[model samples]
Target: MIRITFPDGSVREYEAGVTGFQIAESISPALARSVVSCGVNGETVELNRPIEADARIALYKFDDEQGKHTFWHTSAHLLAEALQELYPGIQFGFGPAVENGFFYDVLLPNGEMIKEGDFKKIEDKMIELARKNEVVVRQEISKADCLAQFGAAGQTYKCEHIEQDLADGSITTYTQGNFTDLCKGPHLVSTGDIKAIKLTAIAGAFWRGDATKDQMQRLYGISFPKKKMLDEYLLMLEEAKKRDHRKIGKEMELFMFSERVGKGLPIWLPKGTDLRIRLQDMLRKIQKTFGYQEVITPHIGSKNLYVTSGHYAHYGKDSFQPIHTPEEDEEYMLKPMNCPHHCEVFAWKPRSYKDLPFRCAEFGTVYRYEKSGELHGFTRVRSFTQDDAHIFCRQDQVKDEFLRVLSIIQTVFTIFGFGEDQVEFQISLRDPEDKEKYIGSDEVWASAEQAIIDACKEKGIKARCELGEAAFYGPKLDCMVKDAIGRRWQLGTIQVDYNLPERFNLEYTAEDNSKRRPVMIHRAPFGSLERFTAVLIEHTAGHFPLWLAPEQVAILPISEKYNSYALEVANYFDTVGVRATVDNRNEKIGRKIRDNELKRVPYMVIVGEKEAAEGTVAMRQQGGGDQAVMPKEAFAERILGEVAEMLKATNLKPEN
Candidate 1:
């Protein structure tokens, strides 16, 4: 018998060679039935794989992330099986689970084509194969044998992948029915578990995401354990289509992309630019209240700057090629990160312990080279500005600074009306054994990591811990927020770093007259203006709050006859700091209201004959309702009052 450790710190005796399924069965039959995968000593693996020694184990149900990944992974194999049956000589490349679904890249035989119309037939065939309940078998094979199997089967793509990527003893193959592919899998027990299947899309993709490689058909799909669940998922997908920022951005005339300028660069229109500025001003006011000093940095830096900061080693290849200067040795790179530049600012002058905590903030625009395929409207743009700040403080001040940053994030979320459930807190730490992946000494990394964890604990914040998810320099406190449609997006982050100061040789004189390195805190409540705007647009469905709306009020005249009165109301609103526009277009009163409503203006005022005569304005809310006629002065006060209250309610006062 060997000792088995469970997550709850309970130990039990189990016979050697007992499978994870058997161990789960010993706990409860229900668990055995629901478990799709198991974590053995921190590694996720197939449930039926035998455990020869004592190990820490956690059984995973379909609701768990690992379990869902396992389920979708098996579904990918199931897709390949269906493809093999329907289209003979179909060669498969990479097939892996994605964020919402799974996709398999494949090269079709000569004269064969797969289109959107073929999705139904393919889904039907997948369901048929799933009903077979075929057991998925995993096998370890030598590289020679692996290449031989795929080569003999005329799966050139598979053969090429194995030849190029797999090592001799590291080859593994998973077989379900007649379909066998090279994979290292923690798959579900059988295809029977996949009850509902969807073939969502078919697109062209290059093998291994290489533009130089042959283009293949990428089939995207998703699966669920129950039909009702699949139905709900499909409904969510439909809702997502409606909220897609690209569609809404164009419809609202917020921003656009151009082939003449560049593919991934976004050009913000007048309305979008105005809205972004409002957001920046709000953040600026909050930062000022918290004693943050604002600064500006250049858009490009010497390649050596990144090299010293260690960003070059990690992101250099993915970044745009360096720009050569008049001198051959002098080269510059588009700023991929702001931290390195901030490091330079810290090093420019000598400092004493009195100047220990330096808080510098910037709305710095940076550039990155994102693959064309990965670029989406504003979310994944190549050029964007980060509401970035770097706090250089003494070691003891790390926790307090971190808590202050978290407070800022909470304040912003509250102002945006995000409830606790709509946002998740996570502490991302480095993998303990992977020293090569991160900078800093073990002691420094440990201290920085613990500071973040301890800070969260002290603040009564419950955060999930993710290992091996840290930045190359430090651990992070990340906020993953869900939009109105319940789609999660990583929005804000605060990272603790002890490495950069050491690399830059930044020093501040201590009371003992000894030089000490200052700890760095990197934070961004709005990671990027463009990406946050995209998320906010989707979350509110373009109905911006009164304070943040680009055009808060639309003054709609009954006709050309009341255009003068409309201008009068607009002027009154302008004096009270209300952003209002007069719609004196050649259109009817009803048509004007309808058109302005689609613009998502928070409020609309109708200055008609009665209002113009009475010196009052009729107020209408964006979605609906006539909110009574009020004096023009009274309407301005109402708008101004509501905005002031919103800011007051959400502002965070720094702790003394």
Candidate 2:
């Protein structure tokens, strides 16, 4: 017997060759029925894969993210199997499960193409195969044998991939029914688990994402264990379209991208700028309370700066080429990160232990050479400003500083209506097996990873650990918030680094007057202003909170005579720090109300004969229902009071 530890810290004695499915069966039949996959010592694996030694295990159901990944991974194989039968000689490129669902790239035989009308046929075929309850079999094969099999089958892409990418010992494949594909997978036990299927879309993708390679037809699809779940997902997709930030941004005149100006560069209009500035101001106020000193950094930096920080080695290809100079042969590039520049700032001064915790914040704009095909609205822009900050502190101070950052993140999320239940934390650690993908010594990396774990434990925060997802330099705590529609978005990050100080040779005098390197804490409550704004737009559906709304109130005139009173009410609101706009257009009050409602203004005040003479206004709330008549002064005070309450900050200081 071997000891198998469960996630709840319970250990059970089991036979050495017990499979995950057998282990689940031992616990409960219901659990065995629902469990789609299991994690063995942090590695997700097939349920039937035997555990030959003592291991830590966690069972996953379809509702769990890991379980969904395993489910969709098998569905991708199922898709390939269906396509293989439907379109003989169709060569496959790559098929993988993504955050939403799965997609497979394939070159159809004889220049054939698949279109929207073909989606149903393909989906029906997938369902037909899924009903067979075919068990997926994972096999390890030699590279030569893999190449021979795929090559014999006329799959040039798979052969080429095997020749160029796969090593002899590491090649693996998953076979289900009539189809087999090159894959490394943790798949569902059987195809019958997939009760519902949908082929979402078809797009063209260059083989391996290289623009120069042959473009193949990419089929996007999603599968669910329950038919009802697929129906709900379809409904969510419709709601997502309605809440799309790009569409709402245009209607609200928030932000836009101009083709002539270049793609992936968002230009904030007046309203967007207003909202962004307010967001900055709000963070600045909270930052000030935490003793943070804000700084401004340039948009370009010397190439050597990044080389010294090791960012060039890790992300050079993702950044624009270095800009050459006419004189001195010096090379500069658009800033891809703010940490290196901030490192220079830390090195600028000699410090003692009293000044160990040096915190600097910047709303620094950075650029990346994102592939044109990968760019999305503000969420995936090429140029964006990060609310970045770095804290240099002693080893003992790391936990305190981390908790403080957590407090700020929690405060910000709460103010934006994200509750504790809606937010989840992830501890991203470097992969132990793949050391070359990261920097720093194993000892330092281990310490940094443990610090985050201990901090979260002390704070009583439950965070899921994900291997190989850390920053190249260190481990990080990432915050993902579920939106109103239950879609998770990564918005905040806090990283602990011991490598940068050593790289930059930064030092501070300790209590014994000895030189010591201070630890570095990198954090961004709002990962980037652009991405956060996009999420906010979708989360609130363009109906922003009064405190953050660019135009909190729209003052409409009933007629030409009341236009003056509209402006008067606007002026009064401005004095009281309320964002009020006068809609003194030639259109009637009904049209004006309709337009402002579409803009999602929180309040609308109608200025007519009685209001102009009585110094009062008739008020109507957005989406109707809340109607009242109040003096302009009373309305201003009410708006201001509500905003003040909403803007209230959480406790800035937490116990160490």
Candidate 3:
């Protein structure tokens, strides 16, 4: 008998060689039917794989992330099988499941192409193959045999991958029906589990993402176990198109990109700058209350600095080439990160243990090199500013600092209307098996990881732990916020690091008068200003809150005669700290109101013959119809009062 441990700490005695399917069957018939995969000792695997010894196991249903990965992986294989039947001599490159769906790159024979019109036929073929319910078989093969099999099948791409990337004993293949490809899979039991199919797009992709390699057709697809689920996903995709940030940003003139300036470099328009400044001021006010001292760093830094901090080793390839100076051996690079410079700031002066928790904040801009194809508006940019801060504290104070940072993140999200239910926390740690990928000793890594875990526990924050997702220096807690459309966006991060301090040789005098290394906590409530603004634009559909809106009020004069009165109202609003713009164009009253409404101005004040003479204005809400006419001073007070109320509701003191 073998001991099997479940997630809830329940143990069961099972005969050796019992499969995960059998284990699920022992629990319940319904569970066995619903389970798509199983996790053995934290590794997801096929349900039919035999468990030969005592292990910890978890059965995964379709709702679980592991189960979806397994399901989509199998669906990718099913797609290849369908293509083999419909288009002979199709060669496969790589097929993997991504966050949304699956994509497979392939070289088509005879210069044939897959078009949008062919999507329906391809999806039909996939569904037909799926109904066969063919079992997927996983096989381990020697490199010689693996190459021979794909070589005989005329799959040159597979042969090349085997030669360059695969080892003799580390090769695996999955076969389902007529299709066999290179894979190390944790796949679903059979193709029947994929009941619905959609072929989303076809794009040109170079083999292995290398520009020098042959371009292949990449087919993107999605599958679901239920037809209704696929229907809902299609509906969500439609909604996403309507909420695309790039589209809204252009319409609202929030930000722009110029080919002449450069791709992936965003230039904030006048209104966008106004909105961004407000965002910065709001965070600055909150940081002040938390004892954070703001600082600024240069846009370029010595490459040696990053080399010492280990960022050069990790991100150097992705960063722009270093700038060479007239002086020999002197080089600088556009700042790829702000932490290393902040480390220098801490090392600039001597300190005692009393100054241990030194908090420094910066809205620092950094630049990186991104492939043109990979850049997306503000979300993926070449240059962006981080609302970054570092806390240098004693090892014992790590947890307390984490709690404080979490409070700030929570406050920021709450102000943006992201409730607790809409947010998720992920604890990302290093992968023990891949020690080469991360810096620092195992002891320091463990301590830092444990501190974050303990902090989350004390805060009553339930976070999912993911291995191999940590920064090269240390573990981190990341925040993922689901927007109004239910799409998740990563917005905030807090990392605990002990490695950078040691690298920089930063120290402070201890209570016993001996030198001690201070632990470092890296945090950013808004991971980057550009990315955060993009997500906010999409989340709110470009309709910002009154306090954050670029143009809070639009004053429209009913006629050319009332233009002076409109300017007077705008002047009065400016005195009262209300951001108002006068629309004094020669258009009619209705046209002016419609234009301002489309601009997403929160309030529009109409100054007509009666209002100009009465020294009052007619107020109309953005989406709401006309509110009652009120005196100019009363209107200004009302706007300020509304803004104050929003801040008060969030438990934040409004800044003057």
Candidate 4:
């Protein structure tokens, strides 16, 4: 008998070689039926895998993320089987489960092609295969045998993958019916478990993700055990399409992209620029209250700067190629990060313990060379501004500084109406086995990691820890916010670093009169101005808050006759620090209102003969029905009052 420990710390004696499925059965019939996978010790494994020694186990159900991943991974194999049946001689590449679904990359034989129109046929074939309920069999194979089998079958992609990527002693494959593929799987027991499937989209992806390699057709799809769940997922996807920021940004004329300017570089139009400036001002004010000193840095830095900071070692390949100087052998790179420049700033001035926690902030625009296929509107642009700040402090001050950064993130989220439940914190730590890849001594890494964990504990913040997710120089805390459509986007980040200071040889005279390295904390409440705005555009569906709205109010004249009164109303709003515009074109009131509403202006104030004579304005809230008419001053004051209340609640006392 061996000891098995449950997550709750309860231990039980079990016979050696007992499978996880048996353990689940021992717990309860309901649990056994619901469990899709199990965690043996810390690794996720199939329920059918036998355990022969003492272990810690956690059974996973559909509600758990790991279980969902396992389900989707099996769905990918099922998809491949369906495709092979429908299209013979279909060579396959990697087909892994993604955040939402699964995608299979394939190379069709005889010049065959797959497109969106073929989704229905593939979906039908998948359902037919799923109903057969074929059991998935897992097998461990020798690298040589795996390559030989795939090569004989004319699967050059599989043969290449096995021969190059797989070690001789570490190779596995899964077979379901006549379809077999190389995989490291914790798959569901049978294909029939996938009751519903929907093929989402088809795109071109490079084989092995190398741009120079042959491009394969990638098909994206999702599966569910129930038809109703699939329907709901489809509905959410439809809603997502409607709320796509790219479509809304173009329709509202907020931002644009020019091929002549660049592919991934976004150009802020007049309205977008106005909105962006407002957001920057808001963040600037917030940072001032937190004692962050604003600074500016050059857009280009010497390649040696990044090399010393350890960023070039990690991001150099993907970044824009170095620019050679006209003079001697000097090369500069477009800045990929602001931390390196900030490190230089910290090193510029010697300090005592009194200057321990110096904070510097910048709206720094950085450039990186992302693959052309990966670029998306404003969200994934190559050139973007980071709402960046770095804090240089003593080791003892690390926890307090992290708490303050957390407070800033919480405050920003609250002001934006995101609740605690709508956001998640992820603590990313370095990989222990890959020590050479990361900077800093083990002692410093431990202290920084512990400080973050303790800080979150003290704040009562629930977070998940992810290994191998840290920056090359340090551990990090990331904030992911889920939008209205249930799509999660990374919005903020905080990193603790002991490596940069060491690299730069930055130090401060301690209270004991000894030189000590000051720990660096890198944070950004809004990860990037461009990406945040894109998320905001999608989350609110372009209906920005009154304080941040590009145009808070639109003064719509009932007719050209009341244009003067409309201008007066607009001027009044301007004086009150409210953005407003007058629509005096020859258009009907209904048309003007509709147009402004589509623009997502928060309020529409109409002026006509009666309003002009009475010196009042008619109001209609965006998405809200017509509000009662009121004096122009009363309306402006009401809007200002609401903004003040929100700011006050958030404790955002931006510096004048």
C-alpha lDDT values of all predictions: 0.88, 0.92, 0.92, 0.89
**Would you estimate the TM-scores of all the predictions?**
0.95, 0.98, 0.97, 0.95
Query: What tens-digit string does per-residue lDDT give for candidate 3 at 41-95?
Result: 8788999999999999999998877888999999998988888888999989999
Across 52-87, the per-residue lDDT of candidate 4 in tens digits comes to: 999988888876777888889999998999899988
- Candidate 3 weakest lDDT stretch, 10 residues: 647-656
- How far does residue 641 in candidate 1 sit from its true spot (Å)? 2.5
| TM-score ranking, best first | 2, 3, 4, 1
Query: What stretches of model 4 exceed 4 Å from their correct place?
Result: 1-13, 653-656
Error of 2 at 482 (Å): 0.7
- Which candidate wins on TM-score? 2
Point out the worst 10-residue segment of candidate 2 by lDDT. Answer: 647-656
Better of 1 and 3 by lDDT: 3
TM-score of predicted structure 4 = 0.95
**lDDT by residue for model 1 (576-637), tens:** 68889999998988998888877888899998899999999999998896588999899888
TM-score, cand. 1 vs. native: 0.95
How far off is residue 153 in model 3, in Å?
A: 1.4
Q: What is the lDDT of residue 51 in candidate 3?
A: 98
Q: What does the lDDT come to for candidate 4?
A: 0.89
Clashing pairs in 2: none
**Cα deviation in Å at residue 73, candidate 3?**
1.8
